[model samples]
Target chain A: AQSVTQLDSQVPVFEEAPVELRCNYSSSVSVYLFWYVQYPNQGLQLLLKYLSGSTLVESINGFEAEFNKSQTSFHLRKPSVHISDTAEYFCAVSATTSGTYKYIFGTGTRLKVLA
Target chain B: SAVISQKPSRDICQRGTSLTIQCQVDSQVTMMFWYRQQPGQSLTLIATANQGSEATYESGFVIDKFPISRPNLTFSTLTVSNMSPEDSSIYLCSVEDLGRANYGYTFGSGTRLTVV
Candidate 1:
């Protein structure tokens, strides 16, 4: 079974400050990693995904994550954040092998950007 | 990206009643799933909605309590039977869009069901 673990439950960052949300996973087989953001009263939206060929995956909104296979970590990073970036982020993992296609989501990290 | 349209954004139902949530996708998808988000908790997948056959439910979830139906590739529905206070949660519909190298999932806004 594949499982995702988000280390931080809540993180507060000032505007223009760097932020990193940690995520780790446990899986026996190769897996795909993803980050999702959920704003207030909204559904979960995909931020970025690391499928293959790239250790670092980036989103259009200045968010990036690096997939480190040795460490079993895929941490999300941002050079600077804005007040609008305040949202709950989730780390999810799914198997690359065939037979199943269910995503295992982490507990979630709440990014509270203070102006 | 796939677009999912879910009905009844929020509903306040009395105990012993049942509520059905519907999800309509704009395009055909092979993977459609149902998830539940409880208060102050992470999203937990309820079941995988298959097009023709019976839905595959996760452990701890049963067909008698939460029945699911997928009539086509673009539509699915989930019904919560015998509503109770414990059933108060946000129900979301998810669909996957596979690309050549990568894929991402899209979700409905979610239906907030408050059982009283």
Candidate 2:
């Protein structure tokens, strides 16, 4: 069984300020990590993912996350955020060895970018 | 990634009634799943919509409450039976896109159901 933990339930940052949403997972086998963003009244959009390459992965929208195996963490970070960046972010983990192909998601972190 | 079109973007139904949500994928997908997102909560997998077979449900979910039908590889429907205020939430359809290196999942716009 796998579980994800997101300590921060909500995070507020001023426009152009930096932000980090932490995510940790517990799984016996190797796993893939993903970050998803959901705006108000919309479906979730993929932010970035870590499959098997370099520990660090980035999304086109200037957000990046590094997979730290030792710490079992995949924290999302943005050097600068905009008002448009206000959304709920979710962390998900999928066991690589599980053929079932199911994802276990974190509680989610609400990012509120203020002006 | 496959694109999903979900019907009945939103609805307000009476308690004890039922609501059937539909999802149609643009391309053939090997795996399609249904998820429920409660207010201010993360997504929870309700079941795996399997083609040509019974859907596999997750723990705490039952086929009676959430009847799923996947007639083909590109279409599926999930019906919420005997709905109540607790059933008021966002229902989303998802498909696994193996073509991507990261194996990311594509999600539907979600059907917002409000039980009154």
Candidate 3:
């Protein structure tokens, strides 16, 4: 079984400021990491994911996340955020061998971009 | 990623009633999953809908309460039986499209059920 933990419940930042959303997971075997964003009343959208190879992954919208094996962490970062980035971000983990294809999601971090 | 469409985007039903949510995908997918998100909480996997087989449910969820059916690879239905206020949440359907390396799962717009 895999579980994910997002450290922050809410983060407030000014427009154009940098932000980081911390995420940690617990799993014995290899796992796939993902970040999803959900706007109000909408479904989740895939922000990025860390599968194999390169530990660092990036999204088209200037968001990036690095998978740290030792720390069991995959924290999402953005150099400069815009007001459109304000939404609920979730970190998820799924076991590599588990054929169930179920992803355990974190509590979620609400990013509030103040203009 | 696959395009998913879910019906009954939102509804307010009375207690003891039932609501059936429908999900349709543009392409055939190997796996389809149903998830629930309570107010201010994260998503919880309810069950995995498989064609020609009983849906595999997770802990704390049962077929009696939430029945699922997948007639084909591109379509599935989830019925929330005996609705209660506790069942009020956003129900979403997701499909796994392994073609994309990073984006494997695509989600539906979700049905917001508010039991009164």
Candidate 4:
């Protein structure tokens, strides 16, 4: 089984400021990490994922996350934020070789971008 | 990624009644999953709907409470039974899109159920 933990419940930042959303996971085996964003009254959208190859992964929307194996962390970061980035972010984890597609999500961290 | 659609985007139902949510995928997928999101909470997997077999439910969820049917690769349905105020939440269906090298998952818009 895999579990994810997002340390911050809420993170507020000014527009154009850099920000980071912390996420950690516990798993006995190899795992796949993902970051999803949910806007108001909308379903989740995949921000990015870290499967293999590089420890760092990036999304087209200028968001990036680094998968740290030793620390069991996959923290999401952005150099600059926009008002549109104000949304709830969730961190998810899944076993890499379980043959099952079940994902364990964290409680979530609400990002508030101030203008 | 596959384009997915869910029916009845939002609904209000009486307690003890049941609602069936439909999910359709534009492309064929081998696996479909049902998830529930409580108010101001993260998603919880209810069951995995596989074609030609019984759905595998996660812990704390039962087949009777949340019955799932996957008759084919591109279509599935999830019925919430014996609803209560606590059962009011958003139900979403997701499918694994293997076309991407990372094998990411795509989710439907989600059906919001409000039981009164």
Candidate 5:
């Protein structure tokens, strides 16, 4: 079984400031890590993911996350956030089970970027 | 990545009623996932539907309460039976992006059900 934990329920930051949303997971086997963003009234969009090889993965929108196997963590980071970056971020871990993959998601963190 | 179109974007249903949500994928998929997100919470996997097989449900969910159907490779449906206030939540459908290296999942916009 796999589980994901997001410690911060809400985070507030001013525009152009850096931000990080923490995500930790526990799994018995190798798993794939992903970060998803859900904007207001919109569907979830994939931010970035770490499958293998590279420890760090980046999204086109300037968001990045590093897969730290030692720490069992995949934290999302952005150098500068914009007001439009306000959204709910989720961390998920997918592991193969019964020849199929199952995903476990974190509780989610709400990012609020203020100008 | 496969694109999903989920129907019944939102609805207000009375207790004891049932609502069925649909998902249509742009491409063929071997598996489709259904999830629930309560108010201010993260997503919880409800079940995994596969074509020509019985849907596999999670620990806390049951087939009777949330019946699932997968008639083909590109479509599936989830029905929330015996609705109550506790069942009020956003229901979403998802599919894995086999074409991408990350193997990330694509999600539907979700159906927001408000039980009254």
Candidate 6:
């Protein structure tokens, strides 16, 4: 079984400021990590994912996350954020096994970017 | 990523009523899933819809309460039976993206259900 924990429920940041959302997970086996963004009235979009190889992954939107095996964490960060970046971000994990792909999502973090 | 078309973006139903949400993928997908997002909670897997076979449900969910149907590789539906206030939540359907290296999942826009 796998579970994800998002440390913060809401984050307030000024435009062009930095932000980080913490996420930790517990799984007995190797798992794939993903960050998804959900804008207002829109569906979830894949920000970036860490499956194998590099411990660091980045999204096109100036966001990046590190897969820390020792810390059991995958925290999303952005050096500067835009007002349009205001949205809910989710951290998810699923077993690396081929057949089963049921994802366990963390409680979402609502990022409120202010002007 | 596979594009999904989900019907009934939102609805308000009376207690004891049922709602059937549909999910249609643009291309063939091997795996389809049903998920629920309760208010202020994370997304939880409800079941895995297997084409031409019975769906596999998670621990707390049941086939009776959440009947799933996958008649083909590109389509699936989930019915929330005998709904109640507690059942009010955002229901989303996802399909596995086989083209991706990680086989990431693509989600629908979701159907927001409100039980009165």
Cα lDDT, all candidates: 0.93, 0.94, 0.92, 0.92, 0.94, 0.91
Q: What TM-score quantifies how close candidate 6 is to the native fold?
A: 0.95
Binned by DockQ into CAPRI classes (incorrect, acceptable, medium, high), candidate 2 is high
- Per-residue lDDT for A1-115 in model 3, tens only? 6789998999999999999999999998888899999998899999999888999999999999999999999999999999999999999997865554558899999999999
Each predicted complex: what DockQ? 0.86, 0.94, 0.83, 0.84, 0.92, 0.80
Per-prediction RMSD in angstroms? Answer: 1.2, 1.0, 1.1, 1.2, 1.1, 1.5
True contacts kept of each: 0.79, 0.89, 0.68, 0.79, 0.93, 0.71
TM per prediction: 0.97, 0.98, 0.97, 0.96, 0.97, 0.95
TM-score of chain B of 1: 0.96
- Model 3 spans with C-alpha error above 4 angstroms: A97-99, B100-102
Per-residue CA lDDT of candidate 4, range A18-82, in tens? 99999999998888889999998888889999888999999999999999999999999999999
Q: Model 3 Cα displacement at A107 (Å)?
A: 0.8
Off by over 4 Å in 5: none
On a 0 to 100 scale, what is the lDDT of residue A66 in model 2? 100
lDDT tens per residue, model 6, B1-116: 68899989999999998999999999988779999988777788899887889999989999999999899999999999999999999999998886656468889999999999
In the range B1-116, model 4's lDDT, one tens digit per residue, is 78899988999999999999999999888889999999988899999998999999989999999999999999999999999999999999998877657477788989999999
Docking class of 1: high
In candidate 1, which residue ranges exceed 4 Å CA deviation?
A96-98
Candidate 6 structure quality by residue, lDDT tens digits, A8-104: 9999999999999999999989989999999987778889999988999988889999999999999999999999999999999988545665588
Task: Give the per-residue Cα lDDT of candidate 3 at B12.
Answer: 97
Enumerate residue pairs that collide in model 3. Answer: none
* Residue A71 lDDT (model 3): 98
Clashing pairs for model 6 are: none
